[model samples]
Target: MKNLNRKNAIVMGIGLLMLSVAQIAAHYNPNMPDSYKGFFMGTGLGIMILGLIKNKPKRAS
Candidate 1:
């Protein structure tokens, strides 16, 4: 139902995020400062939090 759809969406979002991170890493310059790493980690964490917030809660039935 709706819960299943929500879960699927979250999974898809996570998958996309992972792919994006992989692509960035592949082309990223090694000499860059650690600030870039911090930014990427922050973005990943923010996405995870967003997914958690969007998830449906279980019914009390």
Candidate 2:
């Protein structure tokens, strides 16, 4: 299995941190709107996806 590059690893870490922050914020404020939570969750997922993705190798003709 290939290992993640330093930049990708950092991006994943930031995404995880954002996810945790969203959860904690929601927990502390029960009245938080679903939209706000969804925004953070979605953004985190997107960031994580970017971090996990690798470039596809080009096939020689």
Candidate 3:
């Protein structure tokens, strides 16, 4: 817990959230809407990317 910095924590959290959603989707009925599934996966990817990439801090020398 203490070892987890802000950026790492955010990324990990988002990754876990995405994973949970994917797991649920995977076990669900195939009758689900493609658009909704796509949207959830896409949004999860986008959020994960934002948390990992956009939240990175610049190195100072």
Candidate 4:
């Protein structure tokens, strides 16, 4: 928790939202395509990776 900052938090939040949408759509909408769910899942994972990468502490060169 201490390592998390505002920017990282926002990015993670967005990723979480995307994942939630995918989950909800999976259960509620039979008409929703698998491709859309895959897209959201992939995008959410990518966003979280980016956030984690950005959250890494820089070392002095």
Candidate 4 residue spans exceeding 4 A from truth? none
- Model 3 agreement with the true structure over 1-61: per-residue lDDT tens digits: 4544687678767876886786598668577787767777777777776666655556898
lDDT of 3 at 41: 76
| True-structure lDDT of candidate 4 | 0.90
lDDT tens digits by residue: candidate 1, 1-61: 3554666577657856865784577467676666776676567667766666657676799
TM-score of each: 0.50, 0.83, 0.61, 0.85
Candidate 3: how large is its RMSD?
3.6
Candidate 2: worst-modelled 10 consecutive residues by lDDT: 50-59
Note the Cα lDDT for every prediction shown.
0.65, 0.83, 0.70, 0.90
Local error of candidate 3 at 40, Å?
A: 0.3
Model 1 stretches with alpha carbons more than 4 Å out: 1-28, 58-61
Off by over 4 Å in 3: 1-4, 59-61
Candidate 2 off by > 4 Å: 55-61
Worst 10 residues of 3 by lDDT: 49-58
Candidate 1 TM-score to native: 0.50
Backbone clash count for every predicted candidate, in the order shown: 0, 0, 0, 0
Worst 10 residues of 1 by lDDT: 1-10
**Clashing residue pairs found in predicted model 2:** none
Candidate 2 positional error at 12, Å: 0.4
